[model samples]
Target: MTTARDREILRLAVPAFLALVAEPMFLLADAAIVGHLGTLPLAGLGIAAAVLQTVIGLCVFLAYGTTAGVARHLGAGDLRGAIAQGVDGLWLAVLIGAAVTVVGVPLAGPVVRLFGASADVADPATTYLRIALLGTTPLLLMLAATGVLRGLQDTRTPLVVAVGGNALNVVLNLLLVYPAGLGIAGSALGSVLAQVASAAAFVVVVVRAARRHGAALRPDLPGIRAASRAGAPLVVRTITLRAAILVTTYAVTVGAVADDQEVDLATHQLAMTLWTFLAFALDAIAIAAQALTGRLLGAGDVTGTRETTDRMVRWGAWSGVVTGVLLAAASPWLGRLFTGDDAVRDLLVPVLIVAALGQPVAGVVFVLDGVLIGAGDGRYLARAGLVTLVAYAPVALALAALSAGLVAIWVAFCTVFMGARLVVLVHRARGDAWLVTGVVRAPK
Candidate 1:
C-alpha cells in the first residue's frame, strides 16, 4: 500500500536524516577527540558548544522561515519567486552572521565565565569559542542555502555536502589536534574550515539554480524586510526554546557543582550530545512535514495537506518507538564511544535510559512543531513556546535547588518540559486554525 505521498516522505526523510545527523556527528567526533584530553577539556567543550549552539539555534528561523516561504512560492508555480525569497534569506544570514561574530568573539570569555565553570575548564572553552565564532557567517549561509534546497524538494545536495564536510572535518581535526599540537583550538579550527567549504558548495548550487531560473542574484531590500518580518515570530519561538535548553544546562551545572564532581558535568555533556543527535535523527520526518505541508497548502490542496500531516504523525510516533528501543539497548556501551573516563561512562548509562524513554514524546513534538511552522503559524508557536518555558523553568530551578541528581533533572525535562510542548502542539494541530491555504500565508 505504498502511495505517492508515502514515497515522497521516505525520499525526503531518509536523506534529511543523513544530512541532519552529520552536524551532531561533528560534535560527537569533537567529544571523542577531546574526551581523551581529560574531563576538564571535555567539560570545556560542552560549555563552548552550548554557547555556539545557542547562537546558531536562535537563527534557525533563517532556515525554517525560508523553507516555508520558498516552498510556498514553488508550489504556486513561481520558481522565480521561490529563488528570490531564498536569496533574501541569504543576505540576512550574511548581515546577521557578521554582527554576531563581531559581538560574540569579544564576549566569548565572559559568556563561558557566566556558566560558572572553573578556571581550568573556562580557559580552554574560551579558546575554542573564540576560534569557532569565526565560522558564524558560513554556518548561517549553510542554513539559508539548505532551506532553499529543501523548499525546492531536493534533499540530495545537502546530503552530499554534509558527508563531504564531515569527512574533511575529521581529517583536519585529527591532524591539527594530535599531530600539530593545537589541542582544543585545533578542533574548532577544523570545524570552521569544513563549514566554510560546505557553505561555498551550497552557495554555488543556489547561484547556479537562480541563474537557470532567471531569478535575480542580488539582494532585494523589500524582500529581505518581508522575510525578516515573517521570521520575527519564529525568532521569538526559537529564543524561548533555546532559553529552555540554556535553563536545563544551568540546572545541570548547578547539580554537578552540588555533587562536587566534574564527572557529573562531563556526563551531562555526553547525554546532551546524544540527545541532540537523536533529536535531529527524529526530525527527519519533521523536515518532510515542513516541506510537504508548505507545498500542499500553497497549491490550495487542504485535503492533501491534512492527509499528509496525519500520515507523518503516525510515522513520527513509530520512528520514536524504534529509536527509543535501540537507544535503551545501547545505553551501556554508548558512553565508552565518547569518553575514556570510566566515571563518565558509568554515570552516562542510566541517564541515557531516561533520555531514551522520552524519544517517543520528542518525535511527536518535533513533527507537530514542523507542521505548524510549515503552515506559517509562527505567532501561535511563539506564544506557546513562551508559556511552556514559563511553566517549565520554575520546576527545573526548584529541582536544582533541591539538589536533585542528574537523573531527576532529566526526568523533569523529559516528562514535564516535553510533555508541556506536546500538549500545546497537539491542541493546535487538531484544529483548522493553521489550515489556511494559498501561495502566501494569511496573516494572523
Candidate 2:
C-alpha cells in the first residue's frame, strides 16, 4: 500500500527521469547521424561534443538556482515572486550564453588545439564547436525554463517538451545532413533549430502560468543579480567536480596506473559508461529531493522538511543497492555489450564490481547533494566539493605511483573521491543549518 508521500515522490521523479534521459538522447542522436560521415568527422564530433558539454554543463546552476528560488516562493504562497525569479534566471541564461558564444567562436581553433587534436581533426572540430555555440542562448533558455517548471511541480510538461524536441532533432538532422548536403554543419544546424523550438515552447508555458497566477513576465535586474549570486557557488561546485573526472581521465590516458595502457583505458571507459548511466537513474531521486525540500522549507515546515530528507535518503539507499546488485549480476555480460576484446572484458569485470558496490554510497551522496541545493546551501556545497577534491588528490596520486592496475584506480574513485563527498554531504544534511525557512536567498 503506497502512501501519499510515495505517490508524491513518484510524481516528481518519474517525469524527471524521462526528461533527463532525453538530454543524453539528443547527443546520442547527433553521434549516430554524424558517425556515418566517416572517421574524421566522427573524431571531430567527439572533441567538439566534449568541449560543448563541459561549457554548458558548468552553467547547470541556472536550472538548479531557479528551481530552488521559485519553489521556495511558491511554497510561501508568493506565486508572483516565484515567476519573477524564474524570469530573472531566464534573462541571466541568455546573457551568459551570448557571452560564451562571443568568446568561444573566435577562439574555437585554439581551443581544439589545446586538446591536442591533429590538424585533420581540428578543422572540423572547430567548425562544429563554433556552430554549436550559436545555439547557446536557446539551450540555456530551455534549461532555465525547465527548471522553472520543475519548481512549479510540473515535471510532466518538461518531459513532454524534451521528448518532442529530441524527436524533432532526429528528423531535422536526417533531412539537413543528407539531402541538404550540409554534412556535420547540418547536424549543428538541426540541434540549434531544435533548441530554439524547445525554448519557445517553454516560454509559452511559462507565460501562461505567469498570467494565470498574476505574476510578472518581464525580466527584473535585481532578481537577476540575486539569481546570479546564488548560482556562483554552484558553478564553482560543478567545475570542481568536473576537474576530478578530468584528472582521472588524464591519469588513464598517460598510462599512469596500468601497464597495458590501451586495454586499461578501454576497461575504464566501459566501467565509466555504466557508472554514468547509473548516475542518471539516481539523479531522478535527487531531483525529487530538490523540489520537495525547497517547498517544505518555504512553507516554514521544518519538521516536514526533515521527514522528507529521511525518506529521500532511504529511497536513495535502496535504489543504489538495487542498481549495484543488478550491475554485479550483469557484470559478466556487460563487457560483451561494448567490446569483443577478451582482454578488455577481463579488466572490466572487477572494475564493474567495484562500481556496483559503490552505488549505495553514490545514492546517499547524490540525495544529500540535492537536499542541500534545494535548501539553498550552495556555499557549503562549493566548499565541501573543493575539500573532497583535495582529499581525493593524494589517493589519485598514489595510484600513479602504486601502479596498482585499473581495478585499484576504480577502487580509489569509489572509496576516496565519492566516499569523501558522502561524508560531507551526510554531515550537512543531518545538521539543522540547512533547514532555514522563508524565501530562499543568497548569502549577504
Candidate 3:
C-alpha cells in the first residue's frame, strides 16, 4: 500500500529523474556526434568536458544551497521570502559565471594542456572549452532556477524544460556539425545554445511565479549576503567533490600515458560518461530527499523526516540494483552507440561492468548527501568531504602509479572515493545530529 509519503517521494523523484537524465543526454549527444569525427576529437571532448564540468560542478552549491533555503522558507509559510531567496541565488550565479568566463576563456589552451592532452588533441579541446565557456552564465542560472522550482515541490517544469532543451541540442548538433562543417566547434555551440534556451525558459517561469506571489524581482543586498553565507559551507563541500572528480579524470589521463595506452583513455572517457549518466539517474531520488527533508524539518516533523529517509534509502538501494542489472546487460552494446572505435569499445565493456557493480553504493551516497544538504548540515558535509578526499587520494595515486587498466581506475573510484563517501554519509545519517531544523544560519 502506497502511503502519502511514498506518493510524495515518487511524485518528486520520478520527474526529478527525468530532468536529471536529460542533463547527461546533452553530453551523450555530444559524445556520439563528436565520436564519429575520430579518436583525437573524442579524446579532446573528454578533456574539455572534464574542465567544464569541474568549473560548473564547483558552483553546484548555488542550486543545493538555494533549494535548502527556499524549501525552509516555503515550509515556514514564507512563500514570498522563498522566492526572494531564490532570486538572490540567481544573482550570485551570474556573478560567479562572469568571473569564471573572464579567467577561463583566455586560459583555455593552457588548461587543456594541463589535462595532459596530446599535441594532436590540444587544439580541438581548447576550441571546445572556449566555445563552451560562452554559456557558463546560462548554465549556472539554469542550475539555480531548477533548484528554486524543486524547492517549491515542482519538478515537472524542470523536466519539461530539460527534455525540450535536449531535443533542441540534438537537432542543432546534427545540423551544425555536418551540414555547417563546423566540426567539434559545432557540437560545443549546440550545447551552448541549448543551455541559453533552457535558462531563458527558467527565467520566464521564475519571473511569472515571483510576480504572481509578490516576490521581489530585484536583488536584495542582505538577502544575497544571507544566501551566500548559507552557501559557504556548501561551496566547500562542492569543491571537495569536484576535486575528487577532477583528480579521477587527471589520474585516468596520466595513467593511460604511463601505460602507453591511448585507447584506454578513450575507453575511460566512454565509461565515465556512462557512469555520470547513471549517477544523475540515481540523484533524482536525492533531489526528492533534499526537498522533502527540508520541508519536513521546517514543519518541525522530525518523525516524518526520519521515516522518509528510511524509505528513500530502501528505494535508492533497490533502484541501484535495477540500474546495475540494466547497465551490465547493456555493457556490450553501450560503447558502440557512443563510438565506432572497436578498441575503445572492447576496453569499455569490462570497465563499465565494474562501474555497474557499484551503483548500489552510489545510490546510498547520493541520497544521504542530499538528505544532509536538505537538513542544512553543510558544515559537516564540507568537513567530511575533505576527509573522504584525503582517504581516497592515496588509492588514486597508487592506481595512477601502477598504470592499472581502466577497470582498476574504476575500482579505485568505487572502493576508494565512493566507499569513503558511503562510510561518512551513513555514519552521519544514522545519527540524529544532522536533523537540524529552523531558519538557515548566516555566518557571523
Clashes in candidate 3: how many? Answer: 0
Q: Where in model 3 is the C-alpha error above 4 Å? A: 257-261
- lDDT measured at residue 148 in model 1 versus the true structure, 0 to 100: 94
What is the lDDT of every predicted structure here? 0.90, 0.82, 0.88
Worst 10 residues of 3 by lDDT: 257-266
Ranking of all predicted structures according to TM-score, beginning with the best and ending with the worst: 1, 3, 2
Write model 2 residue lDDT over 258-312, tens digit each, in one string. 3465456556655665676688788888888888888989999998888778888
C-alpha lDDT of residue 77 in model 3: 89
Tell how far residue 160 is off in model 2, in angstroms: 0.5
Off by over 4 Å in 1: 258-261, 441-444
Worst 10 residues of 2 by lDDT: 250-259
Question: Over the stretch 141-251, how does candidate 3's per-residue lDDT look in tens digits?
Answer: 999999899999999999999999999999999899999999999999999999999999998999999999998888777877877788888889888988888888778
By lDDT, the best candidate is: 1
Over 288-334, each residue of candidate 1 has an lDDT whose tens digit, in order, gives 98898888888999999888998899999999998899999999999
Residue pairs that clash (backbone atoms under 3 angstroms), model 2: none
Itemize residue pairs with steric clashes in candidate 1: none
